[model samples]
Target chain A: MAKALLLNPTAFEAGLVAAARARALSPAQSAALEAFSKTGLPHRRIEAWKWTDIRANLRDDLSSASAANDVIAPSIFGGLGAFEITIMNGAAEWSGEAPAGVTISCTPQGGPLSELASNHPLANLAFLNTDETIAINVAEGASVEKPLLIRRIAGGGAIHQRVTVKVGACSKVTIIESFDGVGRYFSNSVTEFSIESGASVERLVLQNGSDDGVETALCAVAAETMSKFHQTALLLGARIVRIESRIALGGEDAQADLRSASMLCGMRHADVTSQIDHRAKGCTTRQLHKSALKDKADGVFQGKFLVARGAQKTDARMSVNALLLSDFAEARHKPELEIYADDVECAHGSTVGALDDAALFYIKSRGLDDAAARALLTEAFLGEAFDAMPHPAIERTFRTRIARWLEAGK
Target chain B: MLKIEDLHVAVGGHEILKGLSLEVPAGEVHAVMGPNGSGKSTLSFTLAGREDYEVTAGDVTLEGENLLQLAANERAAKGVFLSFQNPMEIPGVATMNFIRTALNAQRKTRGEEEVSAADFLKLIREKGKLVGLSDEKLKRPFNVGFSGGEKKRMEMLQLALFQPRFVIMDETDSGLDIDALKMVGEVVNSLRAPDRGFLVITHYQRLLDYIKPDRVHILAAGRIVKSGGPELAAELEKSGYDQFIKAA
Candidate 1:
């Protein structure tokens, strides 16, 4: 008998192969699967995924499944009257009148996965499985007053979504995404942001999923000259959730501000990992991440600032803070800087502690009970992460979500 | 309106307040004076229901209500307040919002109506002026970046705002200057009423010169070894706790 194949095929590998068999693959899709078959699911052994073991967490065989329950929940930011784009289980739908200077369309394919993220298994998976993509383009020199909300709600099964957002030169836009799901599902999403010169892009994300859900979001942003990319996210962690950001500054005086707050209770887990590359001179980046956890939950934050050889006068600061409300809660942070430039200013700080005893005593002395004191302290820590949210309505939603989580914890 | 009987408290398994006993009748400010290591802070913490200080044996009451059985917040709702020796600097908490929430919480706990925003702001502004604090200070995060004197003034501000029935001032005069001392006296003197009471714990007799006390008790080694009038503080300042520490 011919020697058996040395590699034993896993369930995910077999499923991925089956998915490829049922579809007519484009060249890029074929290349994406070819790259994924070699890498398969990312395990804890992978450096970038050491804290998030997607291989073990997503072990379900990806057979065909039905759509999610079509229960439409009112938007939390409904009062602001944001233009809503509902993407359910990879199928996109939007109705009603479109706001001025905002254009939305469905495209068969935008482009191939970025060369820098081609090695990422989840990125490859998103590329291989995404057949229809959504493109939201803000025209050059146009200003959109209202917010654009991409409310991605999914049901049970696997979902792969790819969205491309291009903010034209001298234009401004605010976009918010909510990753909310029901039962067990694996979602792989890739969002590309191309911010042109003199443009401003404010993006917010809220991730709240079912207890058995596994989700990963990859954000790749490119900022041109004098462009600004500001991102704020609040994650109420799923069974396994990873929100990763990869940004590259392309021209002079570009700025990027990224912030995230995560609250995890029970046995839930969350990882907010980001890598920002300063490839141009006179660029500035600021990142702040805060997490509050109770029970046996875990929160992870990994941030890296990379300045290339010619990227001088680059100033970047990063701070990661955590509040562990219970003894069993765990927080892990790895803030790093890889600088090859001669003149650059970069600083990072991290702290992980429980609520301050003195502050608790002070609050209680003023007639607040233990629950109120803890909730206030937790909010004080997590609230600052969303303070710079460009939209007031989005900030309010984040605050309400955090309050609900804290109440549930209590 | 406050009374304590044979209070025995332990800190880190060591008895700090051993068989302590004292009483502050309503409408009077009672001062408890002692030297270092006399468990003065422990007494205040235990009285305020700090969880770290275990009450092995004791009974504390406010207006005949069992304060010992209640949490710190419950004790406050029952009209007991403690001006800590060192007020905490809580960053990221809006000063006005925190005070408002605390006031409403106490009201809600007592089944009283919550204060409206305009009413609360009006009350806080009045009390803030009484404590020699400006509106700018009230707008900042609670006590963040405040000087020691400003922190004491903040305590006084809360004192005037809450107007609790029974108040404990633990060494409130330690970090104050002449003006701050007078300000504290003015705030406390204004809040003094027929139904209110004060328990002032201090090291020197300087504060007694301002907020006159009806009774002065010498607390040595966690027990009141002597009780007398305001002159008792003058005597302790002249001689020292050496006499009482040895007697206890």
Candidate 2:
């Protein structure tokens, strides 16, 4: 009998380790990486990874990293005049000088290294091997009028990246993270945000990956008293992609709203998993996820709300809706609510269905052919997820991406 | 003009309209009275090109063009409208938007220009008032959370809006009160033109009292068993469909 050998780490982990060593990672960071290396990449054996086999896709041992050849065009958010930071092949590049009231540094202290090492084994391995982390901090009581855009571009070999955002007390800020890449490379990323009391932060994450690339993003957010945290994510599917968001409401009256829309075509796969924990009383959380899957694509949404015993009067609601365009397309939804407080109100609902025939007939009767009618209805359905976004620019960008996806799919 | 010759329809392998036939020339109103399960609704659904109802052996034509050869929306574009007995409530579809889309689709299919947004808004508002639907009702999702009477009024509003060449009202009076019934009569009376025709299917004669029919027929076992003038409706109301149910 030939024994199966788990001979090599994924290309992403190897590249990340080389990048970290070149940056001369600290002893603590090195130790964290060593611990992460033991577990390696998550495979189909893991319950959460059963649907998307990231390990299978990451089997190749990547070569040494080089500068990606493709030039990244301006972001869809270019008209917003955002403060832009570009990361090419896991290295950070600033367009110009950093803006006032905001400090940007290269460090590994405040990101999701510990969280990744403790919770997700694969993310821990990526963090262990990754080099520098982009640290962004907003000054106390500072109001950022413009959005801070972080663009991550990867090509050829694998890459690992990390980002940390800290919003000081009473400050307001918005951050937009856009991930685009080429070639067959693996990209692993972790983003951690610490929102102080009375602070408000808005975040938008856009991931559009190549057919051969595998991407994973782990986001951990901690919110303080009276703080507000809102995040909207749009994903154009990859060979295999998973985005995990973990939000902890640590202060009274803190609120968190998370919304995501995903469009997947061909044989691509996309999964969005989120967990919201309420540790204090009077905290509220609202989550909505919408996905449109076509061809043989698969989309997954898993959301959980955990309210501690003393977190009384906690209100949390989650809804996940999916539209399957083709008969071969698949969608899986798991919404769970764990509430220990007797006074809390928690509810969750999930639905997966094809477009309504009656509605199609009605739309077609009005003037649209089958294709036009289907596209219009689909856009309207997914548009509901981003309808409540506070920033018009962010909402419009998301809408444009959705339209582009529909148009391209056609 | 619309014509049905030797129409035979079967649903779920069971025959409904067996050799039934009727004709309505332009500028005429024909009423069909039948007992429950006498295939009244099935006839309307078949005429509207619903998928489930099968025409085993029949022929229907509108202005000398084959109606069954066209798709449902195509039939709509060809000026065939059926005011459903139970109007479907589609969540997330705006009432005014759906109406405008359907109207423009019909117009576009017939090589006409699309209705501008401002023009559509004004037209719907005017027609909505004529059908007793307030502006607030039109702003809501299509028929969502609407009362029975309001849903019927919505159907009337569509009728007044589309003004299709051939209109089939299947049990439109089933759920309406006197006021709603009067509203339906007013819509039909307004849309009565030299080039338009109507087929009103009802169980009660009260509706005919509001909008007088040129001819009335009694349907039994999927076939027209008797035909007469306006007095037939009064006679059916006086004596019930008990005799036809036994004969059918």
Candidate 3:
């Protein structure tokens, strides 16, 4: 018998590995786990994990996963009349039946796993080790009137989950994903979206993790001809949070709109990264990100647009703006564009500054005290990201989140 | 209604307003004219309480109250308004919303009731017409995409709405055509009252031809070098401030 090796193994890691091994695993999956035992989890020493010290965050040694019976309170979106699905400790539970024209099932195969298995090590590990995948499919020409809500809750140990969504031709739907937790845990999630030709999908992601929890999410989307994909993400704060998006405009006349707003305070860290590829002609992509950092927090934003050859008439633009409220807070931004087509219109800009003195004075000269003036200005700054959202309910929810954060700061 | 006694100011270590003194009684319009590089703008901004414009000496008072002891917003609530020469264009702020908020804020500070939306709408419409600004202009972001003349018109509109007891017009007619200038004059003449005063700062005599100031003072090297009646404006316009500039 080969003895198990520990590489900076925390109690949490040991418990997660034991639970995963007890659940079933193929020979190849067992071999991959053995390989992971040798190298252990990646640390800040590695090039890609320099800013986020995952190994240090997992220093505690945990033994068992939190019980499944631990109930979570209602979500902030509870009043939106959405069809709610709860995933507790990586297990999906549907309280109500699926809406008409929509089907839900459990699929272990057939997803983005095959496409991304070899490119990214983390994706491969997550696909091979996760218990199951929840699949949602919409029939062709079907329109879903109500939004779908997916809530993920985790505690005590590490949990990885995946979601696959497919929208048929000419279909329309809206999906919202909320990540929340209260204990010391790590949640790694992946969501794959496929939009068929002439389909439209609007997606919103809300991440408000506990101070001790760490969350990382990856979203990969494929767009067909004349299809549209819009995504807006709002993150309050986390110990180490990262959200990555990779979108491919696979057909002509496809369009994508990506926007995000983040508020980081204390010692929290948040990163929003995106890469958009224009592979077809006459495709358009627009991206905007805004961050507000106070105290000793840190924010990171990196965006890139890649236009391939023969992709003429490609219109793309990206901008990132950040506001720093204290001397110790920091903001890092990088906007890149790699264009090979001669007739493309591509541009990127980034700015980091303190609040404007003139505007502050103007607002204060009204009757608002200094604090109220600051809150109002900060809201106006971040509110621009949700300008294009069609649903007023979701927009108002995001605005309320901003207001809550400001109140907590005070 | 407003008084400045030996107000000395400096910017970047250069003294701009050295021992400058002036007084505006209730219901009076005072014009300060001088050559280039005079300290007229400095006086207006300092009174409006802009940061970094150091007040090295003396004091400013309004209605026997020490204006120098208050912040910019406090002074504004005390009925002091400055119509900037070049108004700032805030990209995402709505013009109508900002105006209403500012008005309500001032009222709230003075223990007055908040203005209703219907009342605000009616007031803006009336004031917009008096200032020659169309309804479409009020729908845009605060001053965004507006020309210099249009920006001046916005200032006039704010003046008509706030109705402050003391108003400082800093080169309010810099880029206006004859029609716009006439409209500005009409707004000022309509707002005139026995309890309110106006300080119109200008570089030309044409605007003075419409508003008709009671006294025109020459500011040179941060201090007043000459004071005269309305004819003094035409004299300086024709002969220029060559004598005043040399004397300062």
Candidate topping DockQ: 1
Ranking by DockQ: 1, 3, 2
Instruction: Give the range where candidate 1 chain A is weakest over 10 consecutive residues by summed lDDT.
Output: A1-10
DockQ comparison, 2 vs 3, better candidate: 3
Candidate 2 global CA lDDT score: 0.84
TM-score per candidate, chains pooled: 0.97, 0.91, 0.92
- Pairs that collide in candidate 3 are A11-A61, A11-A62, A12-A62
- Pick the winner on TM-score between candidates 1 and 3: 1
lDDT of 3 by residue, A1-410 (tens): 11248745766556546665675766555655665555455567875556666667776654444643365667989989999888887788886678876888877633446343324445545665676788899889989988999998876567788888888999999999998876777888888888899999999999887777777888888888999999999987688888878888889989999999989899888888788889899999989999999998889887889999978999999989999988899998878899999999999999999888777765665445577668777877888898748899999998888888888871
User: What 10-residue stretch in candidate 3 chain A is worst by lDDT?
Assistant: A109-118
Cα RMSD of predicted structure 2? 3.5
lDDT of 3 at B232: 95
Please, what is the whole-model Cα lDDT of each candidate in the order they appear? 0.89, 0.84, 0.83
lDDT of 2 by residue, A1-410 (tens): 11112357566555545555566555656665665555557778877777777878876666643446566666888898999998887888896766677999997554445442346665565565566788899998999988999988878677778888889999999999998877777788888888999999999999988787788888889899999999999999788888889888989999999999889999889999988999999999989999999999989998999999999999999999999999999999989988889999999999999998766755554345677678878887888888858888789889888888888882
Error of 1 at B50 (Å): 0.5
Worst 10 residues of 2 chain B by lDDT: B88-97
